[model samples]
Target: MSKKLRNHDEVVFEQLLNPEMAKAYLDVALEEYEQDGDLGFFLEALRNVVEARSGMTSLAEKTGLNRQNLYRVLSPEGNPELRTISLILHHLGYRLSVQPIQS
Candidate 1:
């Protein structure tokens, strides 16, 4: 019998459902953003995690944000405020932290 192939997005979402995996993935994405200064990539990565966790509706409820606003904020062209980003991460069981660069 032939094996069925899962959609790439589905596979990613499935793996991201695991909190640890999601955290690692986001960390890597954040590193990439730091290296490349590509905010869009970082936003997309965050959006993926949001989708994996439960989708925008659930996050909106948890963060007390408008669903449409979340979508816009996570969009590729979206520029989210620091507070908004912190709020989203807080509800996602994560938080932002600063570390000194090794010299």
Candidate 2:
């Protein structure tokens, strides 16, 4: 009998293929960010979305960002400015939204 193994990155990439799944992934990341104020999870989710959609090189071209720089900027340690983040999200077919926290 043969078995298949699913990798973490593969799962994430698959989730990114569905708009609802992708949004849920980002929503979890955003909840984490709201809890700890760490942007790594958020950025990582965005990077996964980009990779699933058009890849880093394509995103770099669309966003006018260098390929190497895009990798660096998408890293967990990255601290990209709002405009850069916005541009990347826009190119990836996503946008930021605000909502009131429930009491």
Candidate 3:
């Protein structure tokens, strides 16, 4: 669980509400996958949002990916390359998934 979700529900509620909080928390989960470029959490999070708001065609249009290639990369089983990931991040208005070093 994200510290943001677990410890900051009040803040989260005041700022993000439920669904947005879930996505933010999942962004935290993405950190665990980043060391190896594992796509599990990233894929899962994208799947939920994609299924909710639109499909690959719409997302691809926004990201400037070809629809067929976007479908392959965004598919739950696919591994999106860093460039594709960057484009998706821009299209989604999400940050490039980054982590902070522990002090």
Every candidate's lDDT: 0.91, 0.87, 0.64
Which structure among the candidates has the greatest TM-score?
A: 1
lDDT of 2 at 102: 95
lDDT of 2 by residue, 1-103 (tens): 8889999889879879998888888889989999999999888888888899899989888878999988988889999999998898788677877899999
Question: After superposing candidate 3, which stretches have Cα over 4 Å from the reference?
Answer: 1-19, 32-37
TM-score of each: 0.92, 0.90, 0.60
lDDT, residue 51, candidate 2: 92
The better candidate by lDDT, 1 or 2, is: 1
Model 2: per-residue Cα lDDT at residue 85: 88
- Better model by lDDT: candidate 2 vs candidate 3: 2
Give a tens-digit lDDT track for model 1, residues 36-88.
88787788989999998889999998889999999999988999999999998
Best by lDDT: 1
- Error at 14, model 2, angstroms: 1.2
Global CA lDDT of candidate 2, please?
0.87
* Clash pairs for candidate 3: none
